[model samples]
Each structure stands twice: as C-alpha cells, then as structure tokens.
Target chain A: MKLINKRNFISIVCIFFTLITCGKLLYERALNFTDRYYTDNIFTILGFSVLITLILSLHFYLQKFPFWLVIIAQYALTVGIVFLAIFIHGRFSTNAPTAYWDMFVSITIPFLIGALVYYICFFVQIKRANKVLEKLNSEE
Target chain B: MKLIKTREENLEENYLELHYDKIDEETNAVLDRLRDTLRYIEGTYEDKKVTIALTDIFYIETVDRKTFAYTKDMSVEIKEALKDILEEYSKIGFVRISKSVIVNIFKIKKLQGDINMRVIIFLKNDEKLIMNRSYKNDFYKRLNDLKGRSAK
Candidate 1:
C-alpha cells in the first residue's frame, strides 16, 4: 500500500515535534531543575524527534518487505537513536557516563511500553475487523 | 447482428456459440464479455491442476512473478499472469486494489480507512488486503458502478 503523502507526513511530524517539545518542557519544569538550558534542550529534542520520525517512516517504502524485517529494523534504529541522544545529552550536561545509562533506561522503558500498547491495539483492530467480516458475510 | 434461440433436449449444458465472418472491436467486446462469464479459473494445488470457481476466491496476488488465488482455507497458484486474469475477470467482480493484487469485490465484507490514504478491505474469510492509493480511484469507480447495477 502507498504511504502517507509528503505533505501530510511533514505536517504530522511537525505537530508531533511540537507536542514532544512541550512535553519535555513540562517534564523538566515539574522536576524543578535549578539550571535549565531551555533553547539547547529544545534543539536536542527537535533533532531526536526528527531522526525518530525519519526512521519510522522508512517502513512506508518497505511495505513489500517482510513484516518482521521492517519491525526489527525500525525498533533497532529507534533504540539506537534514543541511546545515542541520551548519551550525548548526558555528556554535554554532566560528563557522567553512568547518567547516560540511567537516562537511556528511562527513555527506552517508556518506548517499550508504547510498543506493547501498539501491539495490543493492533490485535484489537484485527479482532474487530474479523467480527465485522463475519457479520457482513452472514448478511450476504 | 441477429439473435437466435435453439432448444435441444439432449444438451448437457447451456453454451453460447458465435459465428462471425470478421473480428472487430464490437466482436472483441462481446467475446471479452463472454469470456468473463466463465465461472472457473485454472490453478495448481499440491502440484495438481484444479479449477477454482471465481466466487470462491477472496483475492489474487502476484508475488515474485508468480500469481496466487487465495480462498477461505487454501491458496492455489494460478498459471495465468495477474494482468491477464484481471482482464478476463474484471467485468464480474475482480478489481485491482494495488499493483500486485486483484480482489474479488464480492468477497469484501467491508472497507476500513487506513492511514496514508490506503484502504483496508476485510474479506469474508477474515482476511484483509490493502488498497493502494494509485488504484483507489478506479476501484471506487467500479464499486460505485456495481452498487448502481445491484440497486436496479
């Protein structure tokens, strides 16, 4: 199947980037960090989000490819990008390698949860579609 | 053209026979329509050739230059090329939903909108196929025509 058009993809990426940046701002504010580089954090978040979006969109072109291959490639890229971003952020902030590991764990745990939620939702959609198919076939 | 009706008491099955002096566009159209009326297509199941009824197919898909017709419980390899099969069966209900797939519209129970302008067609067999953007217009037009005809 064809992918989302370029225009729509761009719009969606921009909207999500904005939301993520806002979320980051709120998270840091709630933690009450004494020293905050708002502009630098926004830029880092922007770069990370854009990279993740690009990685995820690669699946659109790989529609004919094996599903497992696509999912594995995307998941690998996402994890790698998240780890690299956190590592770099930690290096610039505190120069502590241990902090980077902690940050990575914090980020990846939520990402894994999100992936699990996605699979659950996908399963539900298929189940509902099957039910509708049965109903329609019965009517026929 | 003249129409003729013949009654034969010993005939086993009804058949249409055409006698023409020359083949033209109109004659080709009639022949095409007649071909589409055929009920079965040749397929290979377990290395043995079989005739699969058109109504039994959920969808036909081309993969790596080979074509397969999927039914509720089995998938049979069709010898005919995807385009040729579609050409012969499109008049009945076969519609190209993507570059490599032709779905029997009658087997589609419902269509759901998918992200990225694609459509998910749920079939009677609890299978789903994606209708690509490039073929969306033609597929929808054919569906509308089918609906119109059935309403009459």
Candidate 2:
C-alpha cells in the first residue's frame, strides 16, 4: 500500500474542510430564509454531496483528458442541482414568491468556487511538470 | 531550474541514475546516429557541407537516376545509394517499405493499411509516402523489431 505523502494528505484535509464549511454555509442560508424556501430534501442533499466527492476524486486522479471531462461534468451537475433546488423549494412552499433567483445564486457561487479550485490545482500541476522538464534540460 | 533531492528506498537492487536529454528511445537513437553520421561525413566530404537534424529532414526519395535527400532547409545529393543507406540505418529504425524509398521510422506519425494492399504512411511533417506491396513483409518485420526493442 502506498503511504500518504505530505502534499496529498494536506490536499485531502483542505478539501474535506471546504466541503464541510460549504455544506454548513448552505444549511445556514437555507434556514435563514426558511419562510421563502424548503431546504430539507434528503435526496438533493445526498446528490450534492456525491457531486462534490466526485469532483474531489477527479481533482486527485489528475489525468489530462479526465480532468477536462470532469470539469464539464461538474458544470452539468451544477445545472442539475440548480433545477433540483428550484423544484424542491417550489414543492415544499406554495405561497412563497419565485425563489428561483435564490437557487441560481446558491448554485452559481459553488460552481464558481469549484471551477476556481480545479483551475488552481491544474495550473499548479502544469507548473510542476514544466519545472521537471526545465531541470532535465539544464542537467543535459 | 530547481533541483530536487529525495531519499528513495529499493526492495532488491541498488539504484543507479540514468541521465539523458529526453526519454524516448527512437528519438535518442535517431539524434545520436544523425550526429555521428554528420561527424563522419564532415571528414570525408569536406568540400560539400551537410547538416542533418531530426527536424530538418522532409522526405528521402529516389527519382530518375539518383537518390535525393530533401529537407525543409536544403537538399543533399548523397554519394551512397538508397540501398546502402537503408541497410546502414536499419538498426536506427529506417525501413524500406517500398522498392525505391526507405523512410525514417521516427518521422512517421501514422500508418494506414487498406484492403487495396497499399500502405500509406503519414509523416510528422505532413508528407505522405505510399508503401508498395512487394516490400510489405520486410517493412512489417522491421516495425516489429522496433516495437520489441522499445517495449524492453
């Protein structure tokens, strides 16, 4: 079995912390506007968690083709989650005004954060690879 | 360039660091042989200067009465015939896929073999060469040899 190195371990810890923080933030925001929305759909919550897990897993796997595919998949998943949020929020509350705008903001924020994180990780890997190439060239 | 030093453990054998400019076997062999051949020719053909690099070569062809080596930069009239050059560089992955032409295997990007019994080779520099049916066996054997060596 391969042991967890310092970098990978730190990355995993940060990802888990971010997921937890994001989930709590979503829950708090949903609760604050409970009169305007229904934030207690178990299936939607589970789907969101699975989507985040898949993104994190893809980020770690680090293959070039799959990384790009995963980014596209993440965007598709964000769209699905947005639709689910609107559906659930509408189903639970009848007299509430159109909370679709709230759903859009909630989905867009996480989507942007996910994209930023993915690109940051991708750029770092590219920098690391270029450094290795440069080192090989210099040694020659 | 930043240098990294890390302690690595081995299970059975002592570690030895192998160093080179690039890792691909075909490329390294082609570059090394090209350099050696250029150096050798420098002494023999002092009046006619020839500079051959991996990138300079376009497609080597035989037309009319002489074998001509075409490059993006310049063309060279080799004293050695097509057969002689092919035999000499066979070890360096040159395969005679047709009667009048021997191509640098490293320069080839893809090979398309069709039911019409013709093999079309797409080279890295976007030139295409047709391989005649007569030399198919020899071409296949050379390709297999290269693949076996590279696998190891």
Q: What is the TM-score of each candidate against the true structure?
A: 0.54, 0.37
Best by DockQ: 1
Model 2 chain B worst lDDT window (10 residues): B37-46
Error of 1 at A137 (Å): 1.6
A1-140, model 1: which lDDT tens digit per residue?
33445656776567657877666667768997643456755665567566656776676677555445666677777777767766676667664446456446544654566567856664555455445445535544
Q: What DockQ do the predictions score, one after another?
A: 0.07, 0.01
Q: Show the colliding residue pairs in model 1.
A: none
- A66 Cα displacement, candidate 2 (Å): 44
TM-score of chain B of each: 0.74, 0.64
Model 1's DockQ? 0.07
Any idea what lDDT model 1 has?
0.70
Residue lDDT tens for model 2, B74-97 = 566556677877766666656776
- In candidate 1, residue A105 scores what lDDT? 58
Candidate 1's TM-score reads: 0.54
Question: What tens-digit string does per-residue lDDT give for candidate 1 at B1-152?
Answer: 66578888989977778889988897897677556656788889899988887878889999999999998887999888888987777878789988899998879887776433346887878888887645765776676666554444
lDDT of 2 by residue, A32-99 (tens): 84432335533444555555555545543432234446566666666776677667766776523545
Interface RMSDs of all predictions? 7.6, 17.6
